[model samples]
Each structure stands twice: as structure tokens, then as C-alpha cells.
Target: MLDNKLTYVVGANIKDEKLRDYLKYTENLSGRFIKSSGLTGKIRVNNNVAKLNHRISSDDVIDIDMKTDEHQNIEPEKMEIDVAYEDIDLIIINKRPGIVVHPTHGYPSGTLANGVLYYFKEKNEKCIVRLVSRLDMDTSGLIIIAKNQYSHMALARDMQSKDVSSKESNDKDLNNKIFEKSYIAVAHGNMENKSGTIDLPIGNPNQDSARREVCDEGQRSITHYEVIKSFKNADLLKVTLETGRTHQIRVHLSHIGHPLYGDSLYGTVESEYIDRQALHAYKLIIPHPRTGEQLTVESNLPEDINNLISKLKSEA
Candidate 1:
């Protein structure tokens, strides 16, 4: 029931500051948003229209309406979607393997985005599907979608500001981050170490190839992993990403000789154990786009992965 509106009460510390300064610095709104809202007459103070230069005092109420008329060209397909979390500002979906997240060149319909659009239509909600993150077609896990432009902007800003490469940080520092993503993966071999970090660079050799590799000229990538359980042939790992390079987990694991089971692109080919890559986005922690409150969402392993683990257990 929450609308596309933002409200703030001026505090003593920010009193007497220009509205533009408060919004740009304290509220973290982008310059584009400020200009657009100002032109659209969506900025108000104390029930009166206000400009970006308006001066405010303590106890002043500022409101910004953030509604949009933008529409997506994607066709809405009626399909079942696993919604893990939803609010007026955003939604988190538990994506299944073998389904693309959005429309692409080769995939135009029957995607998660199409299904989400249909879901919104059914609920009579006027919202666009703005994906904040994506999972590969074979990777099953949580995907975030912002319901409005303002929420998308806020989340995107926070994601860009996150320092995912902080290896020596304490628990408090970790808790202060705006977003955290975790995964569960089954690798081909039993790892020698119980826990470890892989700090490397990943890049594609050419633009025509879909493969990613660790190379000297690549961008910095970091992955931290811990052994959750060991089988005779493979090991279960809880992996946390510091940098979200394309195929970072697969490339880094393969570089360290622990490629994920069934990962044909960067590791071994599909086997009887699993038909797709044995990777799942299991958990996510993010701050509410509007309220700045912490939110954590999780998804259990899919049936194929659970069966794979069972098969591995039997062999042990």
C-alpha cells in the first residue's frame, strides 16, 4: 500500500541548509532526480510547493512524489513465479534454473520479467520490473526487482558504493554494508582448506566468447568460501562474493582447481549428478530502499541440488 512518495523531517543539524544540499548530501539523491522532481512540481514543503533552494528549519516536513509513467515493452506471460519477498518499493524472487531473468536477444518471452509483469497485472499494480541483480539462466537463486524508479536509483547507488573487497573488516563493518550476497555451490573436488579467499582478476579473452578467465589484465575479483560438507568426490561450499564480475565464482573456483560440479562453461561438463551448474544464490541482505532498514532474504536449495547431495552422500 506504500505509494511512490518520500518524506523527511528536517533535523536540527540540517536546519538552515538549502533543500538541494540536504537532498544531495544527506538524502543521497542524485542531481538528475532533484532536477526532474523540481521541474515536475513534485517537491513540496509544509504543504506548499518548494524549490531546490528553499531554506528549511527544524520540524519542517519535506515531501517528494516519485511517480512515473514509463512502460516496458516486454510481453507479459502468465507463469508461476516464486516470490520470496515483496513490498511497495521492491520484490525479491526465487528464480529457478533454466529460466532467463529478463528479455535478451535470444530470449524474448517466458522469462522471469515476463512473469513478474503478469503478476503485477493480476494484482492491478502499476509498476515496472527493474532488476537490481541478475542470475545466469542455469543458476538458481534470489533476484531483486525495484518497483519504482526512485527505489531503483537508491538501491543502485548503494550497490555502487559497496566495498565488496574488504577482507580485513570486522563484524560491525560487515553489518554496516548496504547489501550482501551469498551462494551455495557444489564443486568437483574435496577442497584442501576448510576456508579460504580467492583474490584474482577476471576477464573475457574476446568479446565474441562467453567464457571468463583469470588473467593479469582483468578486473579485480574476490571470492571467499568455506567448506560446508565434504563428500567422496565433491565438496559443498558456502561462498561469499566481494566483487560480482561475470562468472566470477566459476572462473575463480576453476582457477583454484575446484570448479563447480556440472559447470560446463568454466569447469566440467554436465554429468549424471546434475544437468546444470551446481550453484545457487542462497541468501541476500539489503537495506530497504526507502526506509533504510535492514532486510534479509533466503532460498533453500532446489530439488536437483538436494538430490545431487543425496547421491553424493550415498557414494560416501
Candidate 2:
């Protein structure tokens, strides 16, 4: 097993006994000559420090080196990106389907992050490409990027759940300050109403597939969807998100029996164009962190989806 050594004193609130607890919590860091030095600048920590409440003061130095089993951390390749709008605050890209947002387990490189990094490097802009939110690899749509850490943190704080107006009363400033996210989804079947809201809770399906499902005990999720186009076997939809969750739209719709056409995990695939799920992040409304202005952005349907719709229409 590889080893990484690290050192750090407990934060101010932590008690003396909790210092060991903090060390044990952090992964990686193992050494033989581990000495617990009194409050010093940038003390080193070892692997076996997992405790809480270790009394540490401000400006305490922390150093840790932990073992990381060699996972594929490869260089990212370049690709084309649909630049919708860009400014110092953020950037919006017309994200496409079948592309992972960031490098992860299965995909270590050639992700959207790689492409965005390349874009910034080409322009010689020394800015960090941070994602405020992410869309799944298979789901295509707009993704918001923050140019710096301040914008990222501010937008993230505003994205937290806030009290929404029930009467549509005044409070316009507060309304615009909070992030309002929206999307468009096409379900496999028609619904009872042309437009309706689903107030359901979402939870991880208690199964081995690692998929999400709708459960009463899960976090509260709300999806507002409207029927866009009706087909013989399927219907195009415009789904707006009142609350964001992992697989929120897909799980909620599948629970109501209107699973998406190309979704294999939640719903069974039943058509020739069924390769990936038919979901897209069509619209996004966010509050400007610096200016506090409202910004709405959207992405059009990709060509493959547009052609699939045309073919489905022709077959019918």
C-alpha cells in the first residue's frame, strides 16, 4: 500500500482530545516518527489522525501526504464547445449529450472540463473554470461556469434553498437573487394534464444498480413540466426545475409512469433512436453575483435529436 504523510494542529474550536480524532478522519498519511508538536506554524500530520475537537488556533499550518492508489489521472484532450455567452462573471455552453461533465471513475480525461480549460488557455486568460452546476453525461443542455472562486462561491450560496413567494407578491429583488433553474424533458407517454407540477421526494433506489427513485422518505423535489409536442408513441416535453436533485426529473417522471423514451435505467428503451435518455437542460435562470441582475440562458435541440424527431414523425 502506498503511503502519504500529513500534519496539522486542531482548529480553534477543537479540544485537545479531539485533535487525534481529526487526524484519523482525513484519508492518507502514515509515518513512523510521528511527533505531536505543540502549536507551531505548519506542523506535519501522519496517516492515523482521525479525530475531532483538537484545539487549534488561527494560522496553524497543516501538511498531509496520503496514499492514492494509482488511478487514471491522464491529460485531457481538446474538443469543440458551443460558446453561448461569456463574461468575467460566468460562461454558458450549449452542452451536448454523451459527454461527461468532469473526469471521473470511468472517464478520466476528454471531458467537458478539459475542453473548457483548453478554451481558456487558448485565449490566454488565467481564470479558473469552475462549474456552478453540472448536467449528466448523457443529458445535453446549458452549463454555467464561474470565472473565479468568488463568483463560484457566491452563486453556490444563493443556490441554497430559500423561501419562495406563495402569493406572487412583490419582493422582486429577493426573487431575482435566488437561482431559478429550469429544463426540458420528453417523456415516453402522454400525461393527464397538458401542464402540471409534481411534488415528490427523491431518494437513492435501495438497489444495486445505483439509480435514483421516488420515495416519501427522501429529499423533497418539485418538477414543473409542460407538454411541448405529442407523437404517436412519445411526447416532447419542457420540464422546469423548482428544486434540483440528482436525476430529479428522470426519477419523478418515471415514478409517475411517464418514463423517458431512451432511458434504459429507469425506463425501458422502445424505439430505433434509443441510445441515451431523452432529457435536456433547456433553460437556466441565475442571479448575477456581482450585479444582482437576472440572467436567463437556453440551448436549442441538437441535430441528432432533431433528426430523430423528424424520423419519428415520418414513420408515423
Candidate 3:
């Protein structure tokens, strides 16, 4: 229903630590970005693109691509979603472990989208799959749901360009677009520093590889980390991404001599939770696609992780 372009630099950050708060609290605001950038476009974020409550930072440029288009009806799904928060414009859900964000293989059904579709189907809300962000199949945390297509494009644009990016590849090598993303993880050993950054290039090793290798020819990747807690034999840390590559967190941690506990792909199988890696997405920040507002979401540790931490601390 909004139909005006608005833009600004955030003068103050409300108590709402997440940008979605602003989207929900402000009446005139239409869109925002959690991790915004320098760019311009005509994208009106709707309820479907991103939530309004996400955190927006001060001195950050914002633009609102207010909707001038006809309305489309979307229904809501009553499917059990651990909704961190919700509004007409966006939905933030805590994704369960072991569920892929999108469909593939024999997982066309029983996915998060499947539950979402069924929930919306029951509510008669005109809903569609316009996810603003993606989480790994086993990663559990806040998953952002953009309600519409315009906001999807706007948000997607900013996420795709947060890091050093390029679009040039030789005919012999037509695969090169680099971006950075941060993460939080529990490492198996004691690191010497309070914080550090890891730079590595991740790339394909063979045709259609599910695994990535550490190579100089690979794309550029960076991961920054700070120890949050130290356990008897393990440590908890918050990782900030500087690039977005498949398994970037896992790979970076492994490369930096602190592989994630139980990480079968990279680390030794000497941890308590052998089936799961000790990594959880604790926070996500971005700018709203439609309104250019800043947004952020934080999640508490999953029960499995908390239990492990507790047990580790008890031993200490």
C-alpha cells in the first residue's frame, strides 16, 4: 500500500537491536538493509521482501522503493514455525537443524518451505517463496523471510555485494564472484588471540564438487573471530564473515588450526556430538530491500549446543 520513495542515514538506533524493529515501529518507513552498501535502484520492498524490525545502523545510506504496483494476496501457514517475530511485511523463524532451506533430492516435502506452504495454505494468506537469505541444511538460527518479490530483489542485491566482488573469468575459467560472510563456532583447541582474521580462497576441486578445497587459485575468503567463552577442552567464539562461500566457516576454522568439533568434513571425530558440527548462526544483519532500513536478528544457542557447553563448563 506504500507508494513513495524514501531514503536517509539512521540518526539513532532504537532499543530494537534488530532492524526489523524499525520496520515495524516506524509508520512511514517501508524498507531497510541489515548489511547495506553503496548502490541505487527501483525496488519497493513489500511485506514479502523483508521484515521491518531488523537493525539499521547510523550514517548508513537507506533507500525505500515504495510499492507502486498492484497488490497480490498472500495467505499465512499455521505450520509450527518458531517465529522469532512476525508482521505483515516479514517473518523471522528459527530454523530447525537437519532441514534444508530449499528443496532438493528426496526432500521436496517436509522442508521448511513445505511447512510454510502448508501454514499459509491453511490461513489463506497469499504467500510465495521469496526468501531474503539462506541457511545451510544443518545450520540452525534466524532465517529471514521476505514477503514479496520487489523486496526480494532489493535485499538480494545488497547481500550479493557486501564483500570484494568481481565478474570477470577467462573462457578457460568462467566462475568468479567473490563475497565474504562471518559465522560463530566452537573450536576444539585453545586459540592464542582474542581475535583474528583468516584469508583463504575456496574453489571447486572437480566437476560439481560438494566439497571445497584450500587453494591459492580459489576465490578470496575471510573469517574474523573472537573468543566468547573458554571451556575445559573447547572454546566458543563469534565469527564475523568477510565472504560467502560454501562451507566458508567450516573451511576457515579448519584452515586456522581450530576445526569445528565433530566437523566430519574437516575436523577430527573426537567430539561428543559426532553427527553435528559445533556451529550455529547466532546473528544476521542486513538492510531492507524496499526501504533500505537496517535489520538484524540474533538467536539463542540450540539446546544441543547449550547442553554441550554446560557439560564442558561443568568439567572445567
Candidate 4:
């Protein structure tokens, strides 16, 4: 367990501003975050709970409790993790397959969160774990974790903007954009189209086999794909997401009759080469929350996928 309270100092410029405005200006907290925290009684002033409309003054101490979910209190475990990048604000990790991103049913520990917590403990930094995005347990790739609430807020807002048309729209402001994620995958079939876009609506399907499908009532999802290399019976694709949804790449590719290799849930064929879906988050471009500078990080293909590709080439 970790302490969640965050304290802020009122500067000279915003001396008499309302608590809400002060938070927005100094901490980059959003109105939605403020309201959500208010509902949970997470915001306080000088140890007393405060409202969004409460006026703030110079030298007045503001205490805020970071919001957390039910599983945040999980004990840390000393598991090995491949760290790609780390700064005061966030950490980028090259997650391996078979490791769950967070704790869930049948898996209460040995998660990425637990490993990250232990890593932080070793460094003597007591901070709550905050994941910016998640990859499926069987999918290996680059994922980010924020060190504090401020960075989390910025990244979360950027991700949300892709779904809704807000003031933080990418067209309106490029610097405030969240992240652009790129992936590489080995699909089951030889795709006819070398490059194309999948503009389809995805929603819950009636079938028990799949949680989502392309339907009329589904949300609009878009995936851009380009074939990188053609193998004997498969194609390696460089896939990008215009709109991120649950299993967007898997669902979209599967809908096109070319599912990911070894993806039992979506692919028609069972691959003997790999145990899980051959999808890897290869690259990510994120703007720094504080500096607004674009930061690009890349993750290499894991050994399993590399070996599979080598086998395909040798047989070709």
C-alpha cells in the first residue's frame, strides 16, 4: 500500500483564485478529474475537505488524494521487467507475453504492476503505480506508466481526445496530443492489399466466441495497415490505430479474413510456431506532459516472434 495524498502550494499569481482554477493552472488538472475526485471526497484544503468552488489563498495548503481502483493495494513482487525508458514523470516498458498488465481474476500477483512496485521499492521511491495504457496479457509491446497524477491526467486526456471531439483535438493543438502507437504483427494469410485502412464499426457481438464485432450499433474504429514482408503463407504488417478500441487490431484484421498468427480467439488456423498472438507494439510517439516535446520509443520484436519470422524465411 502507498500513501495517495498530493500537496500543492499556491503561487503569487493565482493567490486568490478558486481551488478548482488553481488546480487547473498549477497542476494541469482537468474539470472532469476535479468533479470525479470531488464525488469521492478526494479533494481537501488544509486537511479539511473542500469543494470545487472553494476559494484558494496564498500559503493555503491543498491536499488531494489520488484516485485508485480496488486492486491498487496489491503487494509488490520481485519479478524481472524490461524497462525501455524512465524519467521522473513516466516509465516505458517492453512487456513480454504471458505477463498480465494488471491483477485480475485467477491472477492476483506476478503482474507488471507488482514488478514495477518492487522496482520502485528497490529505488526507495514510494509512489503509486499508474498505467497509461494496457496491452493484452498475450500481446508483447511498449506500455507506459505515469509516476504521478499530473502526467496521468495529460496522457489520459490525449487518449480520450481520439474518441471524442474535444478542445484538445490533435488538429487544434499538436503538442497536447497523447500518444501515437504503432504495432507489428504476423497475420495468418497473405493479404492482397499491400496497404489499406480498415474503417469499420466495432461493438459487442451476440456470439459467445467474440466480445466485439463489426456491426451497425458499434463504435467507429479505424486501423491503417501496410504489409512489411510476405512469407510463404503469411504477411507481416505494420499496423497503426486511428481509433483505439478493445482488440482493435485483432478484431479488424480478423474481420478482414486475415487474423493474427496463433490468435486462437480470432484466427481460423492454429499456429504451431507461436503460443500466443504474434502482435508486438513496435513504436510509440508521446508528447512530454510538461515540456510538450515529442518522445519516440521503440521496442524490438521478442525472441519468440523473431524465431517464428526466421523459420518462415527459411521455409520460404
Candidate 5:
């Protein structure tokens, strides 16, 4: 069952702090959320309804019912969804390629968000759909959806706090990060190096243009890639991002002279094995928003990318 309440036992570290301040800092709750919860009388101290200014002491029990009457603007539609993992705080969906993540200008309905809302409604959950991470319409992989305002706020803050300038890309460094996203792709050339880092700034040249390129005056973007296998004409590479920029992996791989196979927007090569970009978001490691425990979720490569890999191997 989904628990919509948060219970915190005051410790020495937070003793004597104001409830509002404790909620904002220690619990990572947004001011708006705190105000709303307070207005709705959802916060209690020691089983009694408490005000925001209530003084907290060690061993005091804090209970917060996080349920809200918030409603989504998008209409829920029944559709098949691949749920990779689900808990009280978050849902990790293994998104297939060629599906929009949410409703946008061009896509008004029939999105993953619509399906998720239907799923939630069927399960009698009355929370807003909050996307912690996003993927392009054609990029298949895992995407995160926060189940409540508190989880959404916490996860969003963690994503923003990521340090993209760090030079380390090893497993230890990745584990230390609040969130780690990994991808697998087939690039159009035999990589000269087995492993390398692409430290480049990315920005769109024109405000209206959707394409992004490396520029001196752009946001700092970093991508770390390791060639997993070499093929006659292409290479299978595992990629990890230090920064999440629009089209980061595509732009980085193309900039390094190894564009992904079948990438129409960024690649110069035409592929017969696949009709879309041979890229997949395969893994994610995140800290649970409420519990602070590490969670690792992964999705297997979709069939198109796998078929592309097999074709490359046969050509070798």
C-alpha cells in the first residue's frame, strides 16, 4: 500500500528548531508545500495539531499527512505502461522508444503522463504526476516519476545540486552522486580510445533552433563514454553523463566524430539496421527522496538497438 504520510522523530540534531524551519531545511520541504500543509492542518507534533512555529525537542514525533487534492491538467487515458519499479514515493517506468514522456504543444494527449495518471487513478492514488527526469520521444529508457510534492521537491533539488565539473567518472564517484544516469549507444566508428571524457559546453546557436552544439559560451556539459565492443563499422559504447543537457549524448558523440548510428538529426551516416538513433537510457542510481537510501534501477536495451548491435557484429 502507498503511504501518503511522513513520520519523523526529532533527534538531537534538530532539537529546539522551529517546525517551519525544520520542515524547510531538515526535511527539504518547499515553503509553498509547508504553507499548504499548515493551512490544511496536516502537520502534527506528538499527535496534536501543531502550528508552524511550534518548538521541537529531541524524541518528539512529527507526523505529516502529505495527501493533497491536487489534480493534473492532462486527461488520463488507458494505455499499457511498463512499470520497472514502484514504491510509496516514486515510480520508475521503463519507457519504450517513440513515445512522448508528457503532453506538450505538439502532443496534447496519448503520452506517458496520461497513462501514469490512469494507472494512479486505477490504484486509488490522488497525487499529481511529477516528472523528476525526462527523455526525448525517441529515446527509450528509464524515467522517474515522483508520487508526492515532498518527493518531487527533494528529487528535483538533488538533481540541481549535481556537480558536473567533477573530473572523476569512476563507479565510486558515480555512487557518491545524488543521481546517476547511464546510457548505451552504437556509434558510427571504431573509437580510437576505449574510454574517454567529453568536456564541452553545449548551447543552441539560435534561440528557435532545437539543435545544440558545443560552444565556448554555453553551459558546461560533460559526458563520459567507454567503448564496450568494437565492430567493423560501429562501436557499442556505454555512456555516463556528468551533466544533463538537451541532446547531450547525441551532441557529444557527434562532436567527437562518432555520431550514433541512425541518428537523423546529428549523424551524417544512414543506417539500415535501425530506423531511429541507436541509444538507450539503461541505468539510473538515485537516493530515495524520503528515506535517503540508495536505489539502483535499470532497463534492458530495446529491440531496435539490440538488433542494430547484432547486425554490426555480423558485419564484423
Candidate 6:
């Protein structure tokens, strides 16, 4: 079970409301979380054990446990994982390309989540592993794993605050942003300028649709890129995403005539420098969930990308 607890103050408008109604409507608690806490007898009202149907007053204090009930079927597997940082609240790991983050179709084992689960089990920690951000299977880089619900909610809210496409809240409150993620990539052609921003819109299509596209009806997507090193045939770039959308970097780069090297899904021609896409999430900056201090985590380029860079430099 996680150490973090969900607490809320009952408002006057929700006076005399049932405990379940207060949790569901007033505090916006998840049904799954409530159910799990109910089974474990962790739900409380005014520091007294209360049932879901208990009536709460206007000034009542509700405290709910944040433990999660997940991965009922998935078992932990011990695999080598590159840990970048670890604390009581969260962990940052360098994920390799070609391996999915979590268990998905055709890959139920050997995933990063499975490895993390084993790590937690070895440490004798009883908490659910929560991924704050996701990277594509072919995209390698630093990723965050929250140890509790509070940290997960903080990091997830930070990501959503930076997202210009989120209609849930106003984007003017930039001070609330607590995380910054950057990437390093090798694209097909030499960039036109040293740095520029791509402010396009991304559209999510139906489930049967193959891919997202730049369209008028799409949400606002922004990506800023700077040419780091120019090679004979390719350019190494440092890309900072102002808004995270699915395939934003790849799509924006491809739209500007510089598809990522070895990106078969979005590139015009095949690449010999690398087999998988040359995109790496090199840097991740986030505030500590408990302390509110800035934490910067980074990872070096993998062997294949490093060797490709060396080959390009030698040729240059």
C-alpha cells in the first residue's frame, strides 16, 4: 500500500451527502480507488472509520488511502533496468528502444513495468508502479515512475498544465508547470536554420485510422528544435517540446522535410546509420513531489546511436 493519503474538506454545498457521493462528486475520487480502500478499511471520515453510505457534515474532514489495486494478472519478472534516480516518491529510469514500457499485446513479460515491479518487490515495498509519462516503443529515453498516487497526480498535472491542447484548464498559469522534458535526435537532412519552432495542430483520428495528421480541427502542438551538430548527410538536433502530442517531434520533423533517421513509419527512405528511430529522450527536469525542489535526470545515447554518430563524424 502507498503511504500517500487522499484528504478533502467537505463543503457546505455537499452537506448531508453520503460518503460515497462526497468522494465521487465533491472530492473527485476514482471509483476503483474507493473500492480498493473500502475493501481494506482505509476510508475515513473525520478520523473515524465510516462506511460508503455514511452522511458527512459541511465541515467534516475526509481522508482516503491512496493504495492501488492493479496488475491482478501480470506477474513481476526480474530484468536488468537502468535506474537514473530514485526517491521515496518516484523513480527515473533510462528505457532502451524496442521494448514496450508496459505489458501490451504480444509482450506480456520482459517489459519495463515488469522489471520495476520486481525491483519494488525486492525492496519489499507494497505500492503500485505508476508511469507519469509515456514514450513510444521505438523511442528510447528517460521516463518517470511515481511510487504513490500523490506523486503521480502531481507529475500528471504538471504535464497537463504544459499541454496547450488541454481544454480542462487555462494555459495562462505557466507558474504551475513543474516539469520539462527534452530530446536529442538525428534527422535526415541538415536543418534550414539553427533553431525554430513548429506551431502546428495535431488531430487524433478514429481507432481504425493509421496515424495522426496536421489539420485545422487538430489541437495546438508546438515543438522547438536547435541544430546541435551538422554531419555530412544528417543533422543532430536538440528538440524541446512545448506541447506533447503523439508523434509530435516525428510528425513535425517529417512535415519540415527532415524525418528522423531510420523512422520507417514516417521517413521517405530507409536509413543505414541506425535500425530503430534515432530519437532519444536525453533530459528530464521535474520538481520533487514531496520537497518541491528541481530534479534533473539525463541519459547518454545508446550504443547504436553513439556508434552512428561516430560513423557520421568520421565520414564528415
lDDT of each: 0.87, 0.67, 0.63, 0.83, 0.87, 0.82
Model 2, 199-284: lDDT tens per residue? 98888767666698778778878888888788876778888776678888889899999998678878876454857787877777
Greater-TM-score candidate between 4 and 5: 5
On a 0 to 100 scale, what is the lDDT of residue 29 in model 5? 76
Tell me the TM-score of model 6.
Answer: 0.80
Model 3 lDDT tens row, 246-284: 888888878768888767777868556535787887777
Q: What is the TM-score of each candidate against the true structure?
A: 0.92, 0.70, 0.69, 0.80, 0.92, 0.80
Q: Which model scores highest in TM-score? A: 1
Q: Single out the weakest 10-residue window by summed lDDT for candidate 2.
A: 27-36
Q: Of 5 and 6, which scores higher on lDDT?
A: 5
lDDT of 6 by residue, 1-316 (tens): 3346767778777667788877765554456656767777888988988888899888898887765554535578888889999877899989999888889888888888888999888987776669998898889999999987667766776677677766523644434646788999999879879899999998866556746777888888999999999998799999999888888899889888999988987887676778888999999988776556789999999998998899889998
Question: What clash count goes with each model?
Answer: 0, 28, 66, 0, 0, 0
Tens digits of per-residue lDDT for model 1, 1-316 = 5667999888887668898888887777888888889888999999899998999888899999877776899998999899999988999999999999999999988899999999998998888899999999999999999998788887766665564444323335334655888999999888889999999989887879999889898888989999999999899999998778888899999999988888888875767589899999999988888878889999999999999999999999
Write out the backbone clash pairs for model 4: none
Off by over 4 Å in 3: 1-79, 166-182
Off by over 4 Å in 6: 1-71, 168-174, 204-210
Give the C-alpha lDDT of model 6: 0.82
Candidate 2 global Cα RMSD: 11.0
Off by over 4 Å in 5: 13-15, 165-178
Candidate 3 backbone overlaps, count: 66
Clashing pairs in 1: none
